[model samples]
Target: MANIKLALVDDHNLFRRGIASILGQVADFELVLEASNGQEFIEKIPRKMPDVVLLDLQMPVLDGTATADYLREHYPLIKIIVLTMHDEDRMVLHLLEKGVSGYLLKDSDPDEVEKAVRKVMDEGVYLNEFVSRAMLRKMTNKTTVVKQSTLYNSKILLSEREKEVLKLICEGLSTAEISDRIFLSPRTVEGHRLRILEKTGTKNTAGMVAYAFKNDLV
Candidate 1:
């Protein structure tokens, strides 16, 4: 298979170069483009489109959030991974709502960077430690609120097997991994995923997971 093309958008030249050097050593990754800010990225992306982008939240001309919005509107196929120091829950959730493929801190290990890249390429989502912790805290609070008002066994009826599949999906298991764990064929697992999406009225896995969380189904 071809190397996954990657772009880096940040105002820090030294950091960008450091990440570029690291990705250079990885056989499966290619550093295709580098930009100083979101504006430059927006201008350059049309000419040198990449498969994935490692973006910083804060930049000079344009910020990551604005750039992410632009990408989601115009270049939705290019997967984005936010790599920044900001770990605030509000910012994390905002990016998640905007459909980022992954989140990582600037202090992440090189191996973790590689793993995040592979995970997003293979599974379409990767949440780092800080983001995961924040999300878990939010989920817990939401679950507490939901338990009091909403009945767990309500109108939304799903089979026990489908519920198990949805739980694994919320836990970030890929279709093939869920199949392996449940001793089912990948096709069957995919069918279950489709059914789950239909039952939840979600268009994608991320939406399905969000629905599950909102309803305290996980």
Candidate 2:
């Protein structure tokens, strides 16, 4: 495949710069554009399209939710991956219901962030471990308004490669270990980790294990 063009849409310049710098070292991806808010992201994208977008949930003019709605309405072909700090189950489900392809926490390490990018491009859903649990609980109760199958949809969305990542994560493998075992670069494993977190709604590996035990994924 050709190089993936990614756009960063977040209000924090420093965070955006940090992520860009990390992707730069990978030497195969490009941070094609950076925008402070959703409006700016829209304006920038009209001139060129990115394969994927790393969006922030909180922003001044256009938050990730509104931005996602607009993107889904207008540019259905473009994929969005939410990179945010919000761990609230409601907020996470809102983004997913908006059709975001991936979700990652802001506190996620840089390596996991990259894995998010790859998983979204290759698979379709990227969930953090903690986020997955919250989302699943809310989903099971049906109080969050996410349909019954939405959580199951997460499993269906992952590729075989991502499933491999999830199984290892549930088994307590660290990112570096997963990298070595999977023959993926560390950065790539990090990306997959982020993706797993988003898809399963689990935050850490331990949480993922609990989720597996609870759901019998193991």
Candidate 3:
């Protein structure tokens, strides 16, 4: 397979260069383009067409949010991975809702950066443990407009035990952690997780959390 082409867009010169250097050492990654701001990144998109873009939230010419909107509308296939200093739940949730492929703290280790990039490329989404829990908390905090009947009509009714497992999963617990808390074996916890996904028709953990909250299941 070809190396994954990546673009970096951040106004901080030193930080951008540092990441460029780090990505340069990776065998499967190529830093094909760098931009100081979102507008520059957008202008270069037609020519560079990177497989993934590591975007900073705050930039001079245009912010990451607007750039993300433009990209999602015009270039839906290009995956966006947010590399930002901010970890506020609202900001992260906003970007996730904008359809970003991944989220990572700027201070993350280089190996984690590479891992997130590769996961987003292969699995379509990557969220750090912190971000994932924050997203779930924020979702459950807000009230959804979808009626309960409309949301659950086609889905299997969740047993009380399954709801307990789903709640822990959304809390970002590993299978073993959940098992210890709930007095079930890890394999049984995994079974519950898979069943919850199937019953709710969600693709992954993030989607499962979203569905649980939107349906007021937790």
Candidate 4:
């Protein structure tokens, strides 16, 4: 199998070089490119797109938050792992909101770094140990800000009637069955389903089901 393509983006020259050198020892990873800062990363990314990006938060031009936002819009295919010294919850939460795959501290060992890169590439998410523990606490307490908000927006983005129709669709109801359940015509149920897809960014029945699964909307 080919190695996973990776990009290292940071403001500090020495730090970038050091990480590149360390990753060189990992045969399963290929250092496809490097960027000095977030702005440089955005400009160079399209030409040398990597499967996973190691992004530093504090950069001269375009910080990690901005970089992540742009990536979410333009390069949604790319997975971002935040590599930063700042462990502040505010910054971490902001990047999470912007759709980062991993949150790793600068002090992480090379082994941990390699693990994070590989895990996110495979699993779509890789949180550092500390970040994972914090996330666990927040989740247990029902204080995970984004999860709730995404669900809430998904709710308002689809009306109450739409949600009723969505739940039935997610339960594997056909348009005809949904029509019988909701007293609407089959064509009307389909229209509601289409609007639900538009509201929730789902492309098909499977995607709609997945959205429902992830947000507990079912």
- The residue-level lDDT of candidate 2 at 157 comes to 65
Candidate 1 per-residue lDDT over residues 1-218, each given as its tens digit: 99999999999999999999999999989888999999999899888999999999999889999999899889988889999999786677667757788888899999999998898888777866676676676677865647732763375778999999999988888989998999999999989888987786654565566556656677
Give per-residue lDDT, candidate 1, residue 35.
97
**Cα RMSD for candidate 2?**
8.8
- Give each model's clash number: 0, 24, 0, 0
TM-score of each predicted structure versus truth: 0.84, 0.65, 0.70, 0.66
lDDT tens digits by residue: candidate 3, 21-103:
99999988989999998899999988889999999989887999999889988887788989998988777766665678778
Which candidate achieves the best TM-score against the true structure?
1
Model 3 misplacement above 4 A: 139-218
Evaluated at residue 208, the lDDT of candidate 3 is: 70
Highest lDDT, which number? 1
TM-score of 3: 0.70
lDDT (C-alpha) at residue 105 in model 2: 84
For candidate 2, give the lDDT of residue 58: 92
Off by over 4 Å in 2: 139-218
